[model samples]
Target chain A: MLTPLKEFATDIRIQQMEEFKARGFGHVGGSLSITDCLAALYGGIMRIDPKNPNWEDRDRLVVSKGHSGPALYAALALKGYFPLETLKTLNQNGTTLPSHCDRNLTPGVDMTTGSLGQGASTACGMALGLKLSGKDSRVYLILGDGECQEGQVWEMALFAAQHKLGNFIAFLDYNKRQLDGYVTDICDLEDPAAKFESFNWYVKRIKGDDPDKIYETILETQKNQKDRPAMIVLDTVKGGGVKQIEDTTLNHHLNMTTELADEIIKQLIKQKEG
Target chain B: MFKCIYNGEKETKAGKTVFGETIRKMIEEDPQVVYLDADLMNSIGTSGLEKSFPNQVIEVGIQEANMAGLSGGLSAVGKKPFMHTFASFAGRRCYDQVFISIAYAKNNVRVIGSDPGITSAYNGGTHMPFEDICLYRAIPHSTVIEFTDSAMTAALLPVIKERPGLTYCRLSRKNCIAIYSEDSVFEPGVANILRDGKDAVIFACGYMVSESLKAAETLEKEGISTAVVDMFTIKPLDTAKVLEFAEKTGAVVTAENGNVVGGLGAAVAGFLSETRPTPVIRVGVKDEFGQVGTPEYLAGVYGLTPADVVAAVKKSISLKK
Candidate 1:
């Protein structure tokens, strides 16, 4: 049988590419980089019921790297949080789908997260709350490699470790690209897995777009972690599906026009038909 | 050393004789009341209550943000959570969480901020939240109240419980003078206008209530008949009463232990500027860092005392002239 999760993620990546193509210009780099991680979470591993967004026992998923909200929106639509048709209204005025997910407005999003480091801290609070109430529910937070530069992220790492919130798992989408330039040029976040591990978290590094690897690590995280939070250094490629954009020096959030949209849609149709 | 003091009396009871004492007492008589503390069981009068009713008391430990979220979670599952912590940390330290988790969700969570304002005493500036009630009142759907005495707190405990929306009770660590009689019941959203006059209204809350009363007496003897109103609920402020007093007097003097910028003065000024538009003078700690002192001395140094109120009235009157 075909792998449902891998196929589904590939489907969402195609959608992610198409949506940006429609916007002509959007957070293409970060969105493309985080698409597969979102797929791995919503498709294969995370236990969430889209119907009951406020379900007391449902697992929570927070996109800490909120600038890549297009990727998360793609996942939410495919998971039936809202109709996939409604996704075309993304970033439009009065649309519930903002550039960054607002938990108050959106259905599936667990917390409103636009500020770089605050989402990680907020997700940590949710995990801590779950543990306090003795709930077995888990929290999956995906952060951007560039966003890791925020000091509050490390503070949360230390807090989660100290609290023994083993139910918490955060994936760092290390696409090496930020708003202005490459992370190496800006300030190299060298060895994020080691940094989190040293901070007493059970952590691992993996190629982020490989849904199989990402999903496996997520499950392994829950099994092995007796105490302390877990961190996954998700090695991703900026603009991964759009081969022209991945790991490019100027790559971060790219804004394209109608012509670029037509060209990208052509490539996506080819990828899907094959 | 459970022998804490409130209203000049040694705080020893069923061991729950502090702010949470009345609630703990309610817990025994009524099964609906429960206590949730963020590792601050000793501070707000739940340290011993937990020992007696293990199932009823929840200790979320030193995480205020998490404690706030858990209060929402617990309340969602049908348990009333009276989350307690110091005024600053619980109110300001995690404002967003309290707004979202408890207030936005419309959960039955009462945030009791103990050691409010300078009552943190030797705990220094970090522990002392000089602007808690302002933060509490800022969030939408928040019902903020500061008790003047142990008697008021004892009366208001049941009042706060019967209502279901979000509420913040600012509690002081020091023993304040019991102002209201034992039978007095505080009406929410209603200002208790004590002594009325055609002069300026002395608006205050919490410890400032007693200090304002003292100031009123002193100002009265000085031939200035000042009207004093206990504006305990900072949010849903009795603007009608404040404006009537402001318009009749044509001058205003607000006293609180908070920064004058956001506390009573701002509320009164915002109202009057829109409707009455009177010459108002604010008497609070002038914009500066607060320090450790007795609640009385701190009130005096910060210009929340009756003498300061009298001075503020004189200045406001001069502006009217």
Candidate 2:
């Protein structure tokens, strides 16, 4: 299970780079940071049907930090929601795969979220609605640590706890960097896990790039949090894989040539094989 | 089958209470219909409903932005969520969320923004929303409906619930002049002609609908026959009806309880300027912020009165070529 999940993460990263290469420039850092978490969910946790994307009882996911749409589109492609070839159409003219996650445009995206701090509240509403309708399907949300600067995120944190949305789960990609600079310099999110804890959410901190840990933490939370929402904070690098991108200071969104993409894909393949 | 019962008296029930009752019926009938409030249930006359439908009625405290996005999320999951808050917060404070999360996302949700304009008389500048109509109308594929009275509030609840995209329902929480009977069935994007005339036409919505009717009566006594139209749907501004009346009358007066810049007056003027150019006089708040005062005092300060409408009608008629 761990080997397949690791390979899934690697494939998502490679395809994400390929899509970015097609688009000339894309949100590279934020998209790569969450690739492993996306792989774990689409591989192990989320209950979704690629053929029936709108299944009423299917578990839903909202990418709150919507700039990471390339990674999500890649995961959806690998999960059979769409063809892998469709990923080349990212941000192109008259394409379904937009730069931001739009539920109407994408097949598996549960909520449309581009503006920060909104998808957090919407995920709570979806969880609450599912609980009200006596459905066991869960709602998973992926938020950026920089996105936490938005007051709406704290508002929803309080709301989800108050509502006792046990079916709601969120992951904060604490990649430590944002568009402008390091999150610590740009309005630091001091002690985010403590913030969620004080807000009464069941909180956990885990290594973000490890697909095994990501899958296990989600399973544990889903079992324990029957009366409270859980917030799993992912401790991650701004650009986790591909040493060339990770070593850079400002890699949030950057130009990725097809040659650079091919080089990164070769490294990923060699690492996976070894 | 639109009937006007403009009897120059206030409705027995407040607009907020009628709205509460209408939603109560919807909640009772459909399990999927959920009511969400930003801790203003009592203000909007929807208090104590949580006891009957605990799962269906949710109180999201005072986070208006959260409530807006949450409503979008609920709609995405097939729940017909009706979110309520002051017009100022519902539109201005949470405008981006409504624009991106709900409207842009194509989520099926209804937002009820109460106490528009001078209706938030005592609540003052902080609570008043003069540009809510403008804010909502600016969103593409969005419905902006203002309730003229209790009957209109009750009648439009069901209609807006089934609307495909985002729908903004603006209404007053307190008593409004009774204009429509209980049996009046209104279709969206159609103008409700209250009184017919050939000299000029007065287009109005919300509390000003009654004022327009009263102005029509006063104009008739002074020998000027003015047509009164309750232009409730502000976004898809009843183009055919507006063109028909502008061609028939050649003079137009727009009355609203909001700022003339982006409210019903602007909609009517912008439409008439492009399609059928006519002499249009706007009777509304003259681009000023609301202040703490009584409803009557605020109306006088902003020139939102039947006398104002009458004067505007006369001016429009005199300006007609």
How many pairs of residues collide in each model? 7, 0
RMSD of each: 4.8, 1.1
Best by lDDT: 2
What is model 1's DockQ versus the real complex? 0.15
Chain B TM-score, model 1, reads: 0.91
List residue ranges in candidate 1 displaced over 4 A. Answer: A21-24, A132-134, A184-189, A226-228, B1-17, B20-114, B123-128, B132-143, B154-169, B181-188, B222-224, B247-249, B315-321
Judging by TM-score against the true structure, name the best candidate.
2
For model 1 chain A, give the 10-residue run with minimal summed lDDT. Answer: A1-10
lDDT of 2 by residue, B173-207 (tens): 88888888899999988889999999999988888
| Model 2 per-residue lDDT at B199 | 98
Q: What is the C-alpha local distance difference test score of each model?
A: 0.75, 0.90
lDDT agreement of model 1 with the native: 0.75
Q: Compared to the true structure, candidate 1 yields what TM-score?
A: 0.84
